[model samples]
Target: MPETLLVLLAGLAAGALNAVGGGGTFVALPALVAAGQSPVTANASSTIALVPGAVAGAWVYRRELAPVGPASTKSLTAVSVLGGGLGAALVLALPSESFDAAVPWLLAFATVLFAFGGRLSGALRGTLDRPLAPGPRTVLVMQFVLAVYGGYFGGGVGIMMLAVWSVGLGIDSATGNPMRIAQLAAIYVSATALFLAISDARSSPLVLTTMVAGAVAGGFGGAHLARRLPARLLRAVVLSTAVTMTVLYFLRG
Candidate 1:
């Protein structure tokens, strides 16, 4: 009962974080692994289950979705689906040992990325007289690579995308957020497709269902809460949770 409740709460928090900011994977992945799923399976399971939540966030921003630059929304979404599929395939092909070894470093990198993403964005904007957008081709290439990462580990991929847009084109985070949510949903769609088709993630039907239920609620409520709460406060709360969880995982290692 305790573990069940924890995973449910983790899903809620993770979904809320994904809605308001990003870094929900940091919560979802670790919580599942702690609940006794293998690293790879946990990742696969979490991706499969939380996909609907990503879609929900994307739906809320559907009308307001912004493009990265010269790259149209259709083009970016296409690349996301392709790259995410490739990433999901990679996870299935790679040995489990490799992911276990890399978990600590991945978590550390994600933690740092989430921590400094905004500062780095601010610095980039400050240094330039006017933020210039990256070429269309460049934006596409960057999105593909980030999509691969998002499909695989997906801890702070949203922050990475925001940074990519911020530096590549001086796009404001607020403006880029809807795009981030949309692209993320595309990636999750493909990744989840692969997980359900080939992975053992479905074996734990109870865990998957519970988390999915909680995530749906969180995603819906979070979308509404985002308008009411200050962005900084929401981010701080999510970041704090991510940092603490990352530290715990590293210490356990």
Candidate 2:
């Protein structure tokens, strides 16, 4: 019962995070793992449960959905679906040990990226005299890779997307957020489809159902709340949750 409650709370918080900024996966994945799931299965199940939250949040911003850089909405969505499915397939193909050992490292890497991604991406483009925004093709390629990563483990995909848009395309994070949510939904939809067919995502029905319910509520509520909250406050809440979760995972490792 206690474990069930924890999963519910995690899902609610994760859904809110995804709606407001990004970092829901960081919260959901760890809680599911702690509820006696294997790392791989927890990752898979978390993806499955969070799909509705992503969709709900995306729907709230439907009217505001816009293209990133030179890429059109349809094109970006296509790449996201394809890359996400491919990443999900890779998870089923690889051995669980590979994921277990890599989990800490992955979390740590995501933590660093979320913490300093803006500066890091800026530094990379710092040498360019023109500092041009990424073109359509460039945006597509980057979206595909990030989608693949999202399908694989998610974690900080939202933050990563914001960084890419903020730095590579000179788009403000606020403007890019709606697109981020939409892309995340696309990735999760594809990944969840794969998980439903081939993974143990449905093995734990109670956990799955509760998390989904919580996520739905949180996602809808958070979307409405996002309008009132400042962007910096939203990012700070996400970053704080992300940093704390990453540290705990490393300590466990």
Candidate 3:
């Protein structure tokens, strides 16, 4: 009962965070691990569980979605879908030992990105003589790379997307947020389809269902709350959660 409750709460929090900014994986993955799932299974299950929430969040922001620099929405989504599927295949192909060892490091890397992504984007923007406006091809390629990573271990990928757009296309967080949510939905949609078809994520059916329900509710509520809440507060909440989870994962390792 307690384990189920933990996952439910975690999913709710994670979905809300993703809707507001990103970093849902930081919450969902560790909670599933603590619920006695193996690292690889937990990762896959987390991805599966977060899909509905991400889609819900994306739907909320559909009206605000925009092209990423020169890349049209359709083109960017295509690359994200393709890259996400490939990354999911890689995860399924790798041995479990590698995934177990990689979890802590991935969490740490994501925490660092969450902490410094804004600063890094600003620094890059300031250092450059002009906005780094790459062609559609270049933007699509970079997005594909990020999408692959997102499929594998999506912790701070949304922030990375914002950073790329901010520096390369001069898009601010406010302007880029809707598209970030949309791309994240695309990545997760592809990954979830793959995971459901072949992964062990379905082993914990009760837990998965519980988390999915909570995530769906949270995603919708969070989207509404995001309009009223302050962005700084949202970022602070996400950063603190990311830091805490990273520290715990490192200690566990």
Candidate 4:
């Protein structure tokens, strides 16, 4: 089969998973690398390709987006945008070898978060839901840091954001979901912009076009399906998939 056909199929699968579960890069990145792209190139390509999917997913949850507090949204957006730019720059400037060693560790951490996500959410709810303490300034700081990580290598960013909001900010996962999507959209948008500014323009347009097509289709499907599925079940599916991918990354490493 032709390589382009293979990439397009992979993009479709990744987009579907991204819309529903997150960690689409676990599929897309390896596909790009196997297609003869360098790790750096593949990483950048995957990041760029995934932007439309993120945007599409965010749009599918547009109604929920309005309920997020404006002040928090603004703060998170600013930090995420700045951090994403910095992270994209670092990715472009640094040697790929530096990141190769770290990928497995990062994947493992993401896996642990996914595997224990429900219990962690429950614990946070028990401790933090009473009287609603003031949000932490430190959480805002951490948001920027996590945004940087997302920009540099965005496999399980959604899960990480959920953890930060639930554990650090004392926000419930259900309440924080829309805000997480918005903040991630900001991060990806900023990172995409930075990559366009710094990197060579070879092969990006083709990848972006096909990816966007798949993402829009999958986003609609995922969002529609989400409305039908029980929240607990949906969350479980995402958690399981994320954990499985993280374990695979560790083994591959």
Model 1 agreement with the true structure over 1-253: per-residue lDDT tens digits: 7778878998898777787777778778878988889888999988876787788888887888877799999999999999898889988988756665665676666567666765665676678755555778988999999899888777667766765675567665566777887888899899999999999998888888888987878876776676565656755654675576567667867
Better of 1 and 3 by lDDT: 3
Of the candidates numbered 2 and 4, which has the greater TM-score value? Answer: 2
Q: Which tens-of-lDDT digit does each residue in 1-253 have in candidate 2?
A: 9999999999998888888888788788888998988888889888888889989989998998888989999999999999899889988897656665676676666657666767766786776755667789999999999898888878777777876676677665567778888898999999999999998878899999988988888887887787576777766765676677668767877
Better of 1 and 2 by lDDT: 2
lDDT of 4 at 44: 76
Candidate 4 TM-score versus the reference: 0.85
Worst 10 residues of 3 by lDDT: 234-243
Supply the global lDDT for candidate 1: 0.78
TM-score of 2: 0.89
Summed backbone clashes in each candidate are 1, 0, 0, 0
Highest lDDT model number: 2
Predicted candidate 1: what Cα RMSD to the true structure? 2.9
Enumerate residue pairs that collide in model 1: 133-169
| Model 2: residues with Cα > 4 Å off, grouped in runs | 99-127
Candidate 2, after superposition: displacement of residue 62 in Å? Answer: 0.8
Q: Native-vs-model 4 lDDT?
A: 0.69
C-alpha TM-scores of all predictions = 0.85, 0.89, 0.86, 0.85
Poorest lDDT segment (10 consecutive residues) of candidate 4: 65-74
Q: lDDT-based ranking, best first? A: 2, 3, 1, 4
**Candidate 1 regions off by >4 Å?**
96-130, 230-253
